[model samples]
Structure formats: structure tokens, C-alpha cells
Target: MRAVIGIGNPGRNYIGTRHNVGFYILDSFAHKNKLDFLPTKSDFWKAESVIDTFRFLLIKPTTYVNNSGLVINELIDNFNLTMNDLLVIYDDVNLDIGNIRIRKNGSDGGHNGIKSIIYHLQSDSFPRIRVGVGKQKDDESLANYVLSKFNKDEINLIDQKIPLLEQLMIEFIANGYEKMLDYFSKESNTNSSNLS
Candidate 1:
């Protein structure tokens, strides 16, 4: 069993913020694949899909971003899955816009949602895809920055990268983490800026 969780705040107010990029990416990916998400009993919206024999769950937490662990842990327990069975995707302000990084495991790097997941799982061994939301300007506070929406130019940049990102999400589901390291590394980061 496999699961992908996209962390973001739930509500119409947060719909277009940079912090919701995870949800944006996952929603678009699911849509492109013709999958529909069904709201579950818990604080999650879920859809199931398959690529060949690989069965995977696509989930977006309906909980606020900081409390995301509750949704993750619930799905983990209900599915009887290990950390290796999960892949998390979220926004990262540390990298430039449209950049993405994939890693097998690491510390949360000060992201509250990641920190909450680490706390609930008591481990940091899960795979993750970090989508860059770009660094905040010096004048903006971190909270204000993340909760802010992308500007028109930034959204256009991300729009250009969507197909590649959707492909990456599909590849992650089909290949797991190891098979595509080079495909998503910094060298490929440059390619994300261009559409094929």
C-alpha cells in the first residue's frame, strides 16, 4: 500500500496561497490523471488510483497545515503502512520558485507540518518532495509570506512547470524514490523552468 499526502491549510481563504502549493500540485496531478477526490470521515480528502499494479492513495489533509500529522498518522494506521509506504509533498520557501527537491529522509527544516509528522510517527524516514515557493522578501514575516498568494508572474512561472511536476508525481508513484533521483536533482531543476 502507498500514500501521498499534500500538506496545506483547509478552507477557501487559503486556496491560492503559496502555502497551499502542495495541495495545488496534487490536485492538478490527480485531475490530469482523471481521478476524483472523495472527502473522507476524517480531516482528509482522498482518491485512489493505480499505475499498472501499483495501488496508491492520494490525500489532502483537511486539517490546518500545523496539525497535518493527525491526518497522516490516521491514514498510516488505517492502511497498516510503514513510513516507507508514504511520500509527502509540500512547499519550501528555501529554494527559488519552481524548484523541487526529492529526498528519502531528513529533518523537518523548521516546517511545522513536517515537524508534526515527525512527532507523530517518531521517525523521519519517509520520502518527501519539496516544491519551491521561493524565499520571502526581507520585509515580510515568514507566516505572512507563506500564507500569501503567488503573484501573477510567479503563478505563470508555475503554470509553465505544471506538466513536468505532474509527470514527476506520476513517476514517484510508479518508481518509488530511488529510481528517479537524477531525474529530479538540481540539474533537472533547470529543466523545470522550460516546457518540453
Candidate 2:
């Protein structure tokens, strides 16, 4: 079984904010699949689904982003899930708007949510997808920028990208990270060649 955890603060106030893109992706995916997130006694809302016979869990921690790891640690223990069976999705200030970067394992890159995960897990050997929310302006504080909502154009761009992001998540579930990476890379090359 695989678990996909989207990192974001829980509550209506956080909706549509840059920091909540992780939750946004999971919500969109669940809606598309006709699944509903059921509240757990634990610190998360979970939706379970089977795609192409692969069982996976969609998780949204009820805890705030900075403490996301608490939920993950609990999940790992209770569900018997290893780090390799997990995929974390979160926002990144370092990436340009609507861009995504996937990695098999790495440091948190100063993301508080990721830092918490690493702190609790005691390891970073897991797959992750980072959604880009764009860099903050020089004068804008990091907290302010991340918590801010996207403008009209930015929202449009994000909406356009959601379909592909959904495809990537599906790919991740149907195949492991290495296979997913290679498959998407080849698909990208094929599309580029066709365009050329």
C-alpha cells in the first residue's frame, strides 16, 4: 500500500492560500475520483482508493503545516508504512509559480513542514513532490507571501497545471517513484519532440 500525504494547515481560513496547494491537489484528486475525505480520530482526514488494483491512502493532516510530521509519524506506525511507501506533497518558495519538482530523497530545504517530518521520521529517504508558489518579493516576509492567495492569473495557471499534477499522482500510485520518474521523463520528451 502507498500513502500520499499533502502538507498544509487545516481550516477554512487557509483555503486557496499559497501554502495550501498541497491540500488543494489532494482535494482536486479526491473530487475527480469521487472520493470523500473522512475525518479520523487521529490528526488527519483520509480518503482511501484503489487505482489499477493498487491500494493507496490520500491523507491531509489536521495539524498545521509546521507540525505535519506528527500525523505522518503516527501513520507510519499505525499503518505499518515505511518511508519508501510514502509520498509527500508540499509547496516550495524556491520554485517558480506552477512549477513542480520531484525527488526521491533530500533535505527539507528550510520548509518548516518538511523539517518537522524529517525531525519525526529521523530520515529523508522518501519521495516528494514540491509545488511551486513563486518566490516572495524582497520586501515581503516569507510567512506573509506563503499565506497569501494567488492573483487571478496565478490561479488560472495553477488550475491549468492541476490536471497534469493529478496525472503525476496517479502515475506515482500505479508505479513506484523510479518508474514514475522515468515514465514522465519519457512522456515529456515525447511531447517535446512532437512539438518540435
Clashing pairs in 1: none
Candidate of highest lDDT: 2
Best by TM-score: 2
Per-residue CA lDDT of model 2 for 11-87, tens digit only, reads: 99999999999999999999999999999999999999899999999999988999999988789888888898898
Model 2: residues with Cα > 4 Å off, grouped in runs = 191-196
Question: What are the runs in model 1 whose C-alpha is more than 4 Å off?
Answer: 185-196
Q: Mind sharing the TM-score for model 1?
A: 0.91
lDDT of 1 by residue, 26-114 (tens): 88888888999999899899999888888889999987889889887789889887787788989889978877778888899889999
lDDT for each of the candidates? 0.83, 0.88
Residue 121 lDDT (model 1):
88
Model 2 lDDT, residue 88, Cα: 93
Model 1 has an lDDT value of 0.83
